[model samples]
Target chain A: MNPPEISAEILIVDDEEQIRRLLRGTLTAAGYRVREAGDGQSGLDEVAAKPPAAVILDLGLPDAPGLEVLQRLREWSEVPVMILSVRAQEQDKIALLDAGANDYLTKPFGGGELLARLRVLLRRPPGPVETGVVQFGTVTVDMSRRVVTKDGRDVLLTAREYALLRLLVAHRNRVITHRQILRELWGPKSEEQTHYVRVYMSRLREKLEDQPHQPRFLVTETGSGYRLDVG
Target chain B: MENTERLRHPGWGYLTALVAVSAATGIGYLIRPWSDYWAVAVIYLFAIVLLGLRLRQGPILFAATLCALTWDFLFFPPLYTFVVTRVEDWMMLGLFFVIALVTGRLTGRIRAQEQAERARAQRATALYELTRVLASAQSADEVLRNAAGQGAALFGARLAVLTAESEQPGRLVLHPSAALALTLVEQQTAWEFFSGRARSSRFAPPAAAGGRAYFTLAVAGRVLGVMVVQPAPGAGLSPAQQELLDAFSTQIALALEHERLRAEHEAARVQAASDRLHRTLLDSVSHELKTPLAVIAAATESLGATVAPADRPLVQEIHVAAERLRGVVVNLLDTTRLESGGLHAQLDWCDVSDLVNAALKIVGDAQLGRTIHLRLPAGLPLVRCDFDLIQQAVANLVHNACRHTPAGVEITVAAGTDEAAGRLWLAVADDGSGLREEQRARLFERFFRGDPGRAGGLGLGLSIARGFAEAHGGTLVAENQPGGGARFVLSLPLQHHEQVPAE
Candidate 1:
């Protein structure tokens, strides 16, 4: 089936006027209609009156309880909901998912990250479908033919290197938790082997970026997970 | 002849009696001529012996009178005649009779009075010693034992005191004695007495199985227990003994009450010490945790601004983790402050919606992409509260919901006024798995966690939140929603007048 176009109405719920204005401006710039709620209760009422395509929710409110707002919204609507919280515990993520949330984002996230997560939620693919050509900084990858060229010159990449690069490129501009990367590469039971992802990611950065120490494309989320900085 | 000398001694009582009888016989002979007075003299000797045994004073006086009469009748007249012809003889008889009567009466009265005074002195001394012993006894058990021993020694009966057990009902510990055997029913009675009930039993009398005693020890009109003493063989307690027992019982009651109060005071002192220590430890640990977390957060925030775009994610993670750690520290500090009377909320009249907005902003910036819903009315009245503190509490609830639930899950916050109850109700609900029965029981207790696996907290968020609510004359409660997830409700008294500053 063809994925829906990126035309959903996004509601920004935040107490800080600056943060709400920032979110409204960012979402509008990304070609989506935006509304704002200053607190949790107003955020819920806005969504209930006319269900939005998606909600960007803040976990703290003054007039009404934050968690209560989340729970009440889940009672009747399944409109994709994303949580905005400062806490980064694994249990928090798990609980939000169990409470009918679709995604989670920690604080201080940039506009790119916000947009990337939105795209993934709105356009979920049924299964892995390979696209033959890939492009980044002056580099083109042809997965079908197993060839790579930088600035139109043939560049050699080992078979292992290509596989690792393809995985990073596929989940570009979004965070891929260490567990997810490990499971995808070495099976579910070996997800705890984070060193393997680190070793391969280092090798990929050396081959692709001008500066491996501070690569523009590959980013580490430190204790939380890893993200691909594809801007 | 030696025996006759011994008999003539007037100081000896027997000799005095004999001399009086002989005199009476001589008088009778002398009076024989006057009248048949021999029988009267013999009767007088018999009366003297009987009176000496019964009316001790009366017998001697009677003997003296009879002697005088015999002299007048038999000796002062012609032989075998009842005639007193001489006036001198009459005066001599009268004088002799008066002397004899006066001597017998004075000696008998003096002896009787001396015996009575000695008995009174013995009783007084015993009473004084008992009072001294009771006053010095330190513990209830000591008082009981001493009382029993004194009762036994004074009354000549075996004594025992049964005291209430520390941890058992209808049970008592019999003080070290073999005087009385206690039955279950009697123990039950004693237990009732200790529990402020009056009970008495004749069936289980003192020092005898099934022989109840006369005196019951009581306090505040309630019997404490019984003081049991067996009656000495073939001897019941005298009036004096009974009075002594009653006095001992009163002392025992007073001593027991004093000991109980002292023990209670000691227990209270120990409890206060423990509470103070616990609070001190909490305060110190929280302070220690706060410093490091603040340092880390500051360091990370500065690093994020300077670091290259590629390294920003790592810096962000550090900042996030530090902030979370700071949240835990703040919770601990709040708890300690409440315990130590150090927390002071700055109260003000603030629009509830504005406070909600501030909390939502902080949570939103932190959450980034997560969804949360709110249902607040536009014209909600201003509430008197500590704005920053309430905001922090709300943030904690929202952050907790986000962490525990799955991504993109919705959380809701709602507020309304209950006019009938004259209160404001704010609720936070989540769609995640609800709290368990055990978790609900201890949800607000410090350092209690529902999920052990979850990391980065001291488990003080909910506890601190509840504490803040209570300080503002409100209550916070948690319950599981029927469909799924959990809901937390915070209710505060609606402000009718101008807000007052926090004291």
Candidate 2:
């Protein structure tokens, strides 16, 4: 069978030349076409001139506010935008998210983790669709019945574990923020409690993956969110 | 008329007795042709004593001379009453009148001088009592009340004290004695006195409110207020009574001045204490930030050095140390900002989980050996707060737990919502040596050290934590856990209206 062709483009916006260079090199080597902007206004202009499939935005911009840029882009575009910032404050993250950034990542992120998040963001399907019996490896998720089977046999899951698994399955092939998972499984106010999500996600991975260390379905986005590999 | 009626009657029945003795002597002379000269002398002495007792010196002398002449004419070889035939008899009568007049004048002068001295003594005693009463008063109100009451009693006049209000237009408070509630007019006159305006009245008729007597109370050219005293009905105060009132007013002024001084002193003492507390807070916070900053600087400098790849964990250690140091500095800055009136929160709706994780990152990095356990329940409400400040406060609590607990001890971060109270509580608990009862009392006090020998810290961690919590309309408390550890809890109001589901 022929390998799938890669076609999505990503824009890297940061003031630091080294960070921009590192991101460009990493993304390019991972089979992605990348463009760069030194400041916020230029990044906005670049997006306006030639819209990319995704954007990697730094919150500390030299010319304009990063949030403003995010807001401006959100006014007309639905392309996924990830905020990069040294400010790891919860309020800052909430503000960026509220301002229309899709996800947030703090500094000192690893290259592999960045690529994994980009891959998931780029692979999001157009809209919600009804699909029965979602399969990954030997584990099959029967969405309608709220059941899971591994090695063609039924698997037992607690009420909480089932809820968590269903949430990840619903947002499959896209980056589901930690806050989003918590809220969906629990409630809106439980978004700050990432620990709950972490515990249940561990349980789900242990049950379904052949080796949980190298998860095929549930993957951490590290500092941003989690993504379920449905492709 | 009363004085005249009292003088109308003869002051003594003894004067009549003397006149009878004179008449009897004349009769005896006539009956016995020659009365003894000794008998005549006794008659003259009796007349002199009678005059001296009844009238003053002049009258006594006249009566004494008349009796001597009568004796010479009737009993000393003169057959008729009026004829003084013997030269010796004439000389004796003249000496008697002179001696009688001199003794009467001396007696009258002595009696008048003694009465004057007694009046002076009475006035002095009244003045002394007035001074004593004014000195013992406590507040300005008390002083005014006492002054008015005492003045009225002492001088038998109605008294009112008016004191000035500190505010604009400088109004007066009229404190009237119970003896007489001042009329509205009298109060207005007192106000006039307060304004240093002169007014007078005869019995202080309402229209002419300034009564016969009113004076402004002044100290060093500044009028404190006024005092008004009206004499008794049907009679004005005597000159002496008025003079005494004036003297007492001066004493009142002096006493009021003393009270003012005392009040000023008390105000200054309170201001000094406030200033001292502010300065101590500043010094404590600055000192606390220094150590953390030094650690951050040292670790950051070391990371730039050439080290073996195998020793990269050392670099990670340095990075962790620096992050911990940064957390400490952030707490100190937060506390200082809160105390110095620089804490302005950019309040927003936040997920408590996000808040908890941010705090955990800072605090978890700082824990060198202890393991921190976080237990956050699902479905807690969003809290409206300054996220940075709340995170720092939590970080400070965690850092405190880490520092106090033994190596490998468990430190737990727990959060929950109190639905009834509409508040959220985040607690950090440590399984280590808990605080003693005494330490718990002052745990949140700035620069208070629980264990002085444990580490070199400025001891501002808990204080800052509490300050930040309180700044957000919350409370922070530290107590020993029932299971033998210390627990620090921060309680904050949950944002009910702005609750947003996490997405």
Candidate 3:
């Protein structure tokens, strides 16, 4: 049971040489093994021959649509995928994320942004409800005890706040839709209870964040939903 | 007048001529002392001329011969005798017969020629009227109705124009408003007419309506359609009338061709406009996208080897530019979809603070120097809306406020609900210099740059923002703030959702 576990490897499926080079250098320096495929067909073949721990697919592949490649890959494997897309296609990003890609990094992203997303995707445990301890900024959450600490001082949360925080921490760095949050905290029929999420989230951030107005850990994903940032 | 009426009947023509001559001879005898016997011969000649004018060739010839015989019998130079002994009297009798034959034939031919000319003139007038009506017709149905009416008047027939339908082969449809109907004979004629087996056909007796003639409508050997013509009651077509039917069928064929070409032209126009729209949409996006890509490339590429704590703003610059570019691109796509009528909102329960916060995330870093304040009541009810579209719209407003205002100005985004109005209000207020006095009207138009001095946008942000707002059954308006800067307010019909039952 104590035998050494091999570190995860990443596969980059993109047509742009600059994008691939940028990703490869950064990911290699971050201590993850990297592989590359230039077009969709070869990418699929590489994925088929030996599945990587994760895939970073560019939406505008030379051989086929990146979504098509993603759909095909989804048929064979459950490897986490992070999509690369130009900012021009917000609709496409939403569709790809909803289509089961783990996350997306819009084009013209810096090395820091790319690495942070990769860390979120690669480092998070596979199970959606894993419970232990997670730290973000100056705040620390103990999931088993259902407690949060800011600067080593205990922070108070109501029953609803604790539930929301626990759920967001379980899926930290990945966006959770408002509907999902409402449903999880308020039960199945509570998807329409968006204000509940908003109020509790603000209260939780106020207690946890150094400044409640400009949150450094709990972040809003604009049109998508919310994400917990571990900086 | 009685004699002329009699002359119209075959047997009665010559009988009437003989009777008139005999009556004149009797009168001549009664006035023997006063009237000359030669006067009786003159009366006989007048009777022959009347018959020639009224009767056809054969009857007029019979009348001419009968009158000459009656003159010899009743008042020859040997009065009341069949024989003429003198050469002078014999020559007189021979000369009278010759004059009668020539005069009769000449008068009959003149009448026939006059009737033919009158018929031809009427056909020309009908054709002129048909062309005039068809020229002003705007659509296929209008053309058919006018043609049917004009054709019925011109040809003395009830007419229907049947268009060959490609979808239902072997079946044709009459123009809906056409007042004409086809019998079995005309229908069969149309079937054969389409195959080029028949050109002009007449019905045996009509199965139902008064339809009689069927003429194939074609142009340059391409059979376009068919025309069913029913001769008017008591006015069955003559040979001349049939010729007119053929001519008018050609006119209908021309109109049908015009209708086909017009439909094709309409389809092509629609296709071309969409293509132009697509090109403009891409142009709006790409032209704006290039600058940000160049900035990002420049910023991120220099991140290596130029590493220093002071250079940290470089990463922030890339992040800001990337976000700014995303907003522009999103607006372009939305504008395209809106223009094409393809963008539809997927409405769901939404929160006002969520919209404000989301917009801040998008435009916050780019305009970091400016302060953005979000104000919302603690318990604003959920308004059903498409969250993404509303976010884009709000981002555009905030981004516009950022672009128009100089650094260090405060921008406020606030929301509230009006219960009585069943509406929700979201407004973005800026403290920078408000809208110019003259720029108010055209500000919401696409590609409208408020001031020439301001730079780096396609001017699509406001128009797209308004487009999103309107799509959710809402209205977006722009106005100058009382003190300074512009105020853009979006009002939506509120659909509030109830609180979820907790487990």
Q: Rate the local accuracy (lDDT) of all candidates.
A: 0.65, 0.69, 0.73
- Candidates 1 and 3 compared: the better one by TM-score is 3
Q: Which RMSD does model 3 reach against the true structure? A: 15.4
As for TM-score, the candidate ahead, 1 or 2, is 2
Which regions in candidate 1 have their CA more than 4 angstroms from the true location? A1-231, B1-124, B135-138, B162-178, B183-224, B229-231, B299-312, B327-399, B413-427, B433-483, B488-503
Overall local distance difference test of candidate 1: 0.65
| Model 2 chain B: lowest-lDDT 10 consecutive positions | B201-210
Per-residue CA lDDT of candidate 2, range B1-503, in tens? 32243355553434554474477476556655464675566556655655554466545755675676566566666555677756766676776676567666766676567545654565677667766776777776677777777766665677766667666365677654434567777667667655545544212222333345666677777777677776666455656666677666777777888889999999989877866786556545543454334334433434435467778777776766555555556556656666666556766555565566667666654687788777866556557787777877888888888877778889888889988887899999988878899999999988888888876467888898888788888999988899889999999987565322233
Which tens-of-lDDT digit does each residue in A120-162 have in candidate 1? 6665422342656767777777767778787788876766667
Top candidate, metric TM-score: 3
* Predicted structure with the largest lDDT when compared to the true one: 3
TM-score of each: 0.45, 0.46, 0.56
What is the C-alpha lDDT profile of model 1 across B1-503, one tens digit per residue? 32243345454544455566675576655655666443554455454544354334444565566566555554444744657666765665565555555555665676567655654665676667667776788777777777767766765666667656467546666777436676778666555655545534312334545355545666677555556566666556655556656666666766777777788999989878977886567644653454355345545654566689999999988877776656555665667767876456656544454456556755765554567777776446557677667777777777667766777767888888987888887888888788889989998888887788976467777888888888888889999999998999888888664332112
State in Å the error of residue A220, model 1: 41
In model 3, the fraction of reference contacts reproduced equals 0.12
> What tens digits encode model 3's per-residue C-alpha lDDT throughout A104-189?
87665666667667776766463554467787887878877777888988998877888888888777768877767877887778
